[model samples]
Target: MVHEYQKDDESSVNSADEALFEMLGILPSLAIGNGVPDEEDDENSMNDKGGAQALSLDRFVQRKDDNWIRKVLANSDNINLRRQYETTSVCVFPEALRIPAIEMRRLADELVWGGHIYPSDKTYETLRISKDGSIEERRALTRIENFVNYHSGWNALCNDYLRRLVSLALGQPMVLYKEKLNLKPPGGSGFAPHLDTPSLRVALGDRGPREFCTVMVAIDNMTTRNGCLRIAKGVWSEDHHVNTVQPKAEGNPDADGRAGAVLPELVDQLQFEDLVCVGGTIVAFNGWAPHRSKTNLSSFARRAVFLTYTLAAEGDFHDAYYQEMEHLRNKWRDKVGLPTQISNDELMELNALSTVPRT
Candidate 1:
């Protein structure tokens, strides 16, 4: 259940305060694990891909028991939010995660120091996965297309809690596909406007190209000043891409079909709303939604986790998708060589992320 951001809610207030303090690197909490932590990090570690521990559907059916769970799901996936998403392609559930601060901090620490924490400098950093799956870190930091490959992070994503939450929100049983965390440190630049469906379509299993959605979990309070995602409203269903740049027309395509950023003019014309919300909020949106973030001017880190899913009937492609990504990353690394990192411009060309942290 999400902690309501209402007045007099001490827990929610404290959580926000703690999140802010943590982002500034001023607060300290118990360090979690010795970096990657082990399988012992979780008892439900079997959440690989969608191979979560098998539970009988009988538990979810009859819909008689667990009224609270049902009610929470009902509220989280209420008609209003669903309608908003359907209409605008974006909606938010503010302060959704009710996990205690101690636990949240522990998880955040594990992810921070776990496998690889890349600096924003892509010039020198590269993550390579050798043919044999051995991981190598060169220069740079992590983002949506390139991010943590650690298993514990995957476990955190496929946990039953999120699965159930996302399932209810999407009104269907979903299989976890790809997960990534965007740790936008203070002063980090935002990404250029782009669509996610083109890449996420591969995880659709049997579903169509548009049969995917992403659930973004806020690890810290997201504010415009700190580089929260700015998304174009009510533009998900349109095939709006053009060979143009900023400063031309309203509602023009931002980019041509291939991997490219939305045109600068389109970005200006589109009505983009900053998704400002407290920590733990879950912002769900369609895969085709055009979204980007801004540079973080505030002295705080904006960390968020994105979990992508398709209907369960299609199949589970989480692990397989990541494995392929690893191979490709390593292959790219080998081709690029070490010491010399890919430039931000090249990264933009490759990932179509319009905004990047100025290094």
Candidate 2:
């Protein structure tokens, strides 16, 4: 089963959606053309995976009359209620932006050259789960921060349709709150099942509002073999159970260490949505959704740009976000008794001079 997050109107569904369906990791012609899955399959996916087909959601929350989705799906621009994402936790826009092959290559090269790449940090919560089920982050992989600051092309791409989609999904106005470049090399470690809201609130420092939306724009083809994102269905922050599967175990390091983890034992309790998106596809999910991905062992590298937005009323936190990241990094380093504070000029020189590996 191939699950696609898209505008509900059948007439408005574009031709690009056809291309998206072809790129899926699952069987394209399952002859299963209905909106959501049958009740039995929706309950538990272990049986499907046992039958040689992994747990896939053709539609978890695609019900037409769903209150949160109905208004936004009406195609009206006047409505501003952002609760749909809160209800479903995830949405997808297929081929939302068309990038030529050459342009996509250029984007990758430019980001590798100018982007400040860092190797995996095992202590970091996002990089904690290694592919082998250990808590180790792999080597020979790197990532970049402040990617939006150096690239105008990305900003243009985001502004083109991301804001409108976000607003429609959220039912309110939106603003770019954060941006990050995630590069998963052959041995890159993926995240565990966890909600994004906990870490986000820490970064936002208890801002007046709580919820935010994320638009993950795929720069490379994401497949199950290449560690694509897998999300649990029908779970949100407001409905989250306090005594439930721990995404991160207790006594890790920080306040958020144990906040978002979904134990391997409890993973079967929730229905899983495997995302096998083609390049240029945009995935919009809410903060409280439980999502995780597998490590990349495939020959090709997986690169993605995550564009996160806060409600327009919450004020733009882009600068504050990076500043807070820097502050927390410094504090963590100091607590562990390590050297701190690497300036932008130093980082640029390192990348420009080819000191450590650029990629």
Candidate 3:
């Protein structure tokens, strides 16, 4: 679980990512996956396109065929989601995304391995020495960020479906802050208990809305053996947890360090519950929630997409956040003498390779 927001205008967005923004009323006049018709088309063609766009908007409002989103929204209200969020800082909706787990997994695979969504430079992998002294690699935790920029389907999921749910929980109109595709392969590493606020503060210092919420849509069945998320009980906001920003040596030892990691002593005091969910489950939590996961001990991969949002009134930081992170990552890579870019072939190979030994 992690939390990370803002509204964007047409002028502020690029062509690729503008569709959803426009539909959200953050901009105007563009339907996702269906752009404006060309001038070369006949009058009838333009009229048909216009009708389709209108129908899309109608469907979005009525949620005609997308009952899963509607059901999740209804359930959110049924559970007194706002109160639960205020008290626990987290909530879960099982199979909320509506799509079958297999279909979700397929979409994830295509986004990662299809080689069209994410650019070569945006793909990365982590390497470690095995017990047998062999070099093994796993896809990096933040495999793809701001994926909504590339694929229309993902764009809708984040800006349309998940965004509406977050807005409901937060009791305000929310906008996209950032989104990521997290892939944890069999034997892949897990994150340490940490609050996302510190890292977000570092990336978006005084930018806009500081408050944030995250929605994680499970793409595969998440279980203890497969590195399911474990969130601590309590609202660990800056005011509630004064020492949240203090780095502890026991935190993430990887490139991210311990910036947001909680003190081990404090973590020991909190009651943690493992969130085991079937694929398509939606887990939403505030940025202040402290959460972590363990390495996958099972023989399958654990995959999920995390989308973060902030109050729309705070101004959009989506583009800025991604740009800053990219810059920092590239700088760090350069300092370490590693290639800053990855090739499509290499990305595919990395996906094919496994840290897990075959039985």
Highest TM-score scorer: 3
- Ordering by lDDT: 3, 2, 1
- Give lDDT tens digits, candidate 2, residues 1-359: 11122223322111243355457643222212112121222112323334443322222212212354444455445422244455567766423122332234345556665434422111111223232343443223245556565566655555534565666555678888766666665445566666666555554457534766778866556777557888775647655732333323322123324444554566567776888765555678877677777765443456677777878887777778767656765665576555575443322222101111111
**lDDT of the candidates, in the order given:** 0.50, 0.51, 0.58
Q: Which candidate has the top score in lDDT?
A: 3
On residues 161-261, what C-alpha lDDT tens digit does candidate 3 reach at each position?
66776676557889999777777654556776777776665555786568888888776667776678889867656688525545333222123344666
The digit string of per-residue lDDT tens for model 1 on 266-286 reads 666676788876554667887
TM-score of 2: 0.61
Using lDDT as the yardstick, the better of models 1 and 3 is 3
Please give the TM-score that candidate 3 achieves against the real structure: 0.68
Q: Is candidate 2 or candidate 3 better by TM-score?
A: 3
TM-score of each: 0.61, 0.61, 0.68
100: Cα error in model 3, Å: 3.3
